[model samples]
Target chain A: MKRNPWRDIRLHGTVLVLVVIAELIGTIKIPITQDVAITIMPLIYTIILGLAFYLIKPIKWIHRKQARIAEGAMMLFIGVLIAKLAVSSGQSIGLIFEMGPALILQELGHLATILVLPIALLLGFKKEAIGMTNSIGREPNVAVVVDKYGFNSPESRGVFAIFIIGTVIGTIFISFLVTFSLSFLPLHPYAFAMASGVGSASMNAAAIGPTLAAFPGLETQIEAFAGFSNLLSFCVGIYIVIFVALPLTEKIYNWLEPKIGRESIMPKKEDEEDA
Target chain B: MPDLIDGSENVSVHGIMNWIFLLAIFSIITVIGNYLGYHHPMESSIVGMAILSLITLAGVWLERYLPFNISSILYISVIGIILAFPGMPTSEFVLHYVSQIELLSIVTVFLAYVGIGMGKSWDEFKALGWRAVVITVLVIAATYYGAAIVAHIVLVLTGVPAA
Candidate 1:
């Protein structure tokens, strides 16, 4: 069915209500220690509330079709958020350029994904680990995996699993991660800001909100670094996944799977099942 | 919605119009959030929303019509940079109003939609099982920390003052 935004008034109205309620609650700080605190922003609350509304079965507030529409709308809304972040990036493009090497090199941090392969293999993930560990499994990354391995391939399943996990709790996890890192890590807030740009719009937004709250008065610079780095990830991320991440993942998987690979938890292949 | 990942789906004029309509609604919600959360004035927030919506629309249009294949985000960022670049004629005006709309407010609305949309995927999420969850968390942490650690090292090496 063609999406009719007008018909999805309930979804939009629900979002509006969530936004208002979330904002009203405002930023809350939970002190974990003398110097450490986890800052929960309105964005996190809004997501939790929205999720509650959708997941709670009794209410049946958001139908399946409506949920799908909301998902589509979320994708569209990202464009607007990107615009806002882009403007921030534009305002301080010069400063961003000044920090050029740091900004660009930080992206290599994406390679850290490979660090999880041994753990995944030990955990019994097999071929799936390639898809799951090669990238962060954002939409584009998922598409790349799907494109190469076919949608039903174990690799696609691996990527899809991470993609689903990302879609469901990525923002919350990232927000908390940023706050937690800020609390303990001795890194500069600017470096944290640059790291917040993990190539996913919602995750980037979630990551930056806490960073901005953690460090007052550097909002513009934080936004600029996060936005520009995210933009770089978005533009160049796919190619890296294809040329660098995938091939490297395959190589590592071949080398590591034999050494530490366990019986796969994933369902056996159809051929094996028939055999 | 269009196939944003592959760029195979052509963005129609009809689709753009729908985006504008949705963006207008998003702007109103964000303005309300900005005022209530950050105590920014509604008038300025509204103006900020308008400017952002315009920039987003222009970027979307360019993405659709431009001969080269490029993400709307890149176009939007370029347009935003051009408008807000130092000494640009419109820079001051653009910054003055748009700055009032807190990035968090926009994020709240965006994530709210994401949360609601997630209902359809809940079963899929559950079916992925505990191992996926564990791995996903580790992967996310690995990527974020890896990036932060790298950036921190470079910044220190380059003599950029820490914030």
Candidate 2:
């Protein structure tokens, strides 16, 4: 059956309703300590509520097809968000140029993903460690893995697992992490804003939302820094993943697999059997 | 691999039409959200969203027609920067209206779609078991903090005061 585009009306309508409700509720701050509070934004609420409505079996409000449509629409909608942020970058181009080194160098922090490999190997992840720890395993990263190794390869499976996990909870996780870090970290808000551009649009937005709320007076600068940093990440990220991250991951996997690697919990692949 | 990797789509007439349709829906919802959440005037919000959508479409056009392979977002960002850069003819007007639409308001609408889309993947999410979940948390923390620490150091080195 040919998919009718109008069927998406249901998904769009639901999101429209959810947005209105979320905006009305506004930002909520829950006190976690004397000096720290977790700031929950309207975006966070809509995501949770939209997920609940979709998952509720009784109503069948969203079909699998509609959900899939929503996913495609999401890719396009992110462009609008990028355009919005890019304009900020343009308006504040002078400030961005002044902070150019910080903006450029902070992306190296993505290399910190390797910090998790030894743990993954110790937990007996095998070749899967390369895919999971090489990067945050967003769509492009997954594609690189799948292209190098076939889709059925262990590395592909590793990348897919991270991609799925990222799609599901990455925004929430990043937001909370940003909020928590803001509470105690002695960093400047601009630094935090630059760090918040983690390559993924939704995740970047999630990270920036909290940082903006925490430092209300610095909104323009924060937006400009985060937006430019994110754009930089998006443009340069794939090359880094393929050249630097993937090769580095393989080397780490080789060196550490013998030192602390445990027996594999996953079944052995055919390639491994021959070896 | 696929279009997702190269960032190129079919760009057929039907595809372009669908994009326009979806963008219209997004703009309407965003205008409503901007009004309710940030109290931006609805008229300005509408104009703001229209400008954004036009920029997005132009970026898409460039992505499809440009000889080099590049993501649409890159084009969109460059176009936005040029249009809004200081002393540009469009800078004042573009910034005036676009700024009216709050970043968080656009985010709220975008993530709602993300959330609804996520429902289909719940079973796959659950099947990943505890180990993947653990690694996901650890990796996120490591990347975020690692980058923040590096940026903080750079900023401090450059004579920017810490908060």
DockQ versus reference, model 1? 0.37
- Candidate 2 per-residue lDDT, tens place, A54-98, comes to 899885667655665665676677678778867877886675566
Q: Please give the distance, in angstroms, between residue B90's alpha carbon in candidate 1 and its true position after superposition.
A: 2.4
Q: Which residue pairs does candidate 1 place in steric collision?
A: none
Residue B121 displacement (Å), model 2: 1.8
Predicted complexes: DockQ each: 0.37, 0.37
List where candidate 1 sits over 4 angstroms from the true fold: A1-3, A99-104, A117-275, B1-14, B144-163
- In angstroms, the error of model 2 at A45 is 2.2
The DockQ for candidate 2, computed on C-alphas, is 0.37
- Model 1 TM-score is 0.67
Q: Comparing to the true complex, what docking class would candidate 2 get? A: acceptable
